[model samples]
Target: MFARRRPCRRPSPDLRCRPSGRATFAAFAVAVTLLPSLAQAQCGGSFSGFVRGLKDEALAAGYGAATVNSFFNGAAQDPKVLKADRAQGVFQKPFVEFSRRLISNDRIQRGARKSQELNKVFHRIETTYGIDRGVLLAFWAFETDYGAFQGDFNTRNALLTLAHDCRRPDLFRPQVFSALELYARGGFDPARTTGAWAGEIGMVQMLPGDILENGVDADGDGKVSLKTSAPDALMSAAKMLSHLGWQPNQPWLQEVTIPADLDLEETGLLHRKSVADWQADGVRAKSGSFALRKGPAALILPQGHKGPAFIAYPNFDVYFEWNQSFTYVLTAAYFATRLEGASVYDAGRPDAGLSGGEMKQLQKKLQARGHDVGKVDGILGAKTRLAVQKEQARLGLPADAWPTPALLKRL
Candidate 1:
């Protein structure tokens, strides 16, 4: 297995590495059209043609032709990256498994130490940005394991491959141009620059477009180097989140207890009701009560009724800008809670969900029976939850809204 990376809101930049013998995909970049020595050499066919087209687009966008061609020349297809592009995981592990791997004892310990060591920086960011330090730390650790292992792919090469592969060209194309745009502004070189497979760069794994638009010069050296500067990366991340409407001091979520007899329809994020409404619904606050955020919240049964339940709030939407997965956001929130000195989930997670492949099969079965669970991407999401609930009700099983092998067999 390879270390997991992010997939952003727009196919924009969920790029990262894969562990298969020959699997990897990363993307989006900028211009390349120098003094036109060999337009014939640079503009051939296949990905080469695509690269030339990208160059023209960049030039039309006001980038220097010399800058564009310098980056585009000798850009060849990366089959490994293409293989990785096609191999995006269709199934997802359960919250329990996913959380365990993402936030282990060692990770928690590191977070604690980082919080202690980076107090001034975190404090500065929070005081200025009104964001929680713990949440920022979670983003940092999750993105590159605290910058321990950012990928080494040539971002331009990776973006080049993804852009030409014909799999979501609309998404990767802009990203490639953005990366080139970033290079045009200087400091970034196509050869020296590298990052996640999808061309995500920096400690916080901000996409190139995001970096260009939202990156901060936290270090104030007159240059923004997310790959090398911590202050710059962290501050940039906080700024991006703030721009995305991160509620200052509002909890991303809180662990809670749902009564066994509670109405199932009231659960899920869409049924957002105030805390008082949830209290009326018999949801008990197992975690510390939300003193500041007392209003609108939604009950999220990430691992179902048997596992830990959380009350998510508006600020939780910021997590979507980082990743679209519910489990990932929950994991990040839980990790931040731990960094803030909170205990592990009192309810703990259940070990009953189906594995990735099993979930994919279950998704297929559900699709066969006519439940549109979206791309059948096995990481059971909202549509899958509704589908599972419908199936459970149809089979006269309790609509717990979680996947299980037994349920699959019954289907």
Candidate 2:
């Protein structure tokens, strides 16, 4: 999730979540005017045509005419959703800055208070799903500040707009149908339900498909009220993470100290080695015990060799399934550790990172050199990092993937 302005926190991702925080209605209305032309172009002509097809599909899928009609009744193209989709480049911030911005003393204290207030709920989630409260709490804090603002976008419009958009129709289109199914089940309201711009519902910002699959009525309310029920939100998140293959009672991330001469090639998400092997290579835990010392782990130099390093375990991989942004995942995972009483990371003196403009230039250079860094969006994404590592190695620099001003100047 990316940062937001005022009252709200941030918007969460969809199945592989993207950021969609709150925006002002004045801004939302302005964005709407800029949408219709692009909407027509992208949705294959007038939005009505797309709605007609959706209605037909719903009817064919066996929903009654009234239900289908009502679901699509007032659905309109929301340009802001598309805007949020494209604006997710904010996740480009390096781990240290991003984490520092998000992990405030207020959030950490609030997370602790929430944990205590919901002790029974947390205990139930842990016992039932084998997931720790910190994971849920961290997400809860990030995705709407523990339910303070679960987005103000109209859920129906947000889903339809994304479904009609060209960029990721496949992901959002199916979610529309899933919302239909939830609506049919007496759970969703076409006009009333609202959350993240990406159509994620509730405090934890789950996609419609996830809600359909993992929703839990933890408070014995007979209905999974994620918006109003803390127990429901936390438990549903735990169940979803469990479904996402979260290893129970396992550590996801741990800050570590690496010897100066450590083989930089062995450090990265792709290169997994046993913890013992890493220890032999002089990667020692910064604090606390390793829950699974023999587990397979990757040495992640998030800001290259000079910045904070972490040993990411298998559970860390599961964060990608929740949100694909490497920086967001690392920050969230690290925050989870912080909520569980881990010490703050020791941020080493990493070289100054590239400006957004410089980063896009670097990405362009990497692409010209035949390395695929996805979009030249100024974000130091995974593919870009890999390309950076290759270039650094070729240039006789440390193969740590962190991009810096010096590297940019050299290139």
Candidate 3:
């Protein structure tokens, strides 16, 4: 089993790890050119070349040869897809800023309206899937801003590029095959299979494999169309969440106040703990209420000791499992609040986020300082923050895992 790391205690500083310098870019360019040859040797031929392999596997898995071949015949490597994949601005901004951009007023308002408009559909989905309608609406908003910007990138092309790229072959190769399976099932025409640069499809931008596994035709049109059908998309998303272990009628997260002397190391909800157990340790609702009556929740310090604290439930982790980004999950929860007619987060605290270039530089510096900051990828995950904390402790700085201009100067 893959070991899950703890969530970030605080919002990541602007200067987390990023991809190495231009040399790395040049190397990537070379790798992309050689990817097809490498893939042919490993799994044989290009994506189309893998057809026979897929056929054998599909037959073993109870699929017919005609079904497998029909799907693979339409699969081809798309150069524009590869170009977009290479052009991604990974680790381009701080998590806080990224979250802010995604959880905008337009998204909130649209989500609220969409929630109201789709009340019956939402209720039916909730009843059938055990996932809340507001949460589903929030996901819809967060992913594509209520379909205002469902990407036009051809998903088959993107998946082919990634599968050929080899850096993450283990992850993407299966997805490529799954997309073929989806095509064979007539979920969507291969010509119209478009989505994000990474091949996530529809309003919620689900991966092809995910769609194949969890998609539902809620409208009963005899088709599962995530692009044109809001009901189908929303129900499919709720089903995905339910499969991911979403608990019905449970809070995803709650703003909370932690005691001044609480141990940061002991802050996570790895094991189930009662709300009363947390209140006994002086944790209180952010609403300033002492009444500690609620369901099980795990404490999350998104910005360590200084930033906002939250009592995140298992449902919150369900959101994280969707994207594996702390900020992404937070934005989903915040958007859900707006769908439920709650106020937006008050920006009383002032912390300017870092730009894309600054984040890249910081990640390089952290890696140079001997921290196991993975890949210098601009996104700050738990590994990157732990590395930052180690360096901060060494420099006698606050081990809060927040990056600052002063820290950059020190580097």
Q: What are the runs in model 2 whose C-alpha is more than 4 Å off? A: 1-43
lDDT tens digits, residue span 236-336, model 3: 88877887778776677777777876655445544346788888888787664432356667776555656666777767878766766556667667667
Alpha carbon lDDT of each predicted model: 0.72, 0.80, 0.63
Off by over 4 Å in 3: 1-69, 87-91, 258-274, 277-282, 288-296, 348-370, 393-396, 408-411
Ordering by lDDT: 2, 1, 3
Which digits, one per residue and each the tens of the lDDT, describe model 2 over residues 1-411?
A: 342211111111222322122312223223323545322323545788988977765564456788788878888889988889778756878889999988999999999999999999999888887888888899998888889989888888988887788766656665776677677777899899988988888888887767877789989979989889989888888987897789888888899999999999778988899999999998898976565778689999999899999999999988887777888889989999999999999999998888789999999999989999987889887799899999999998899998888888889
lDDT of 3: 0.63
Best by TM-score: 2
lDDT of 1 at 165: 66
Top lDDT model: 2
Off by over 4 Å in 1: 1-45, 86-91, 291-293, 347-351
TM-score of model number 3: 0.76
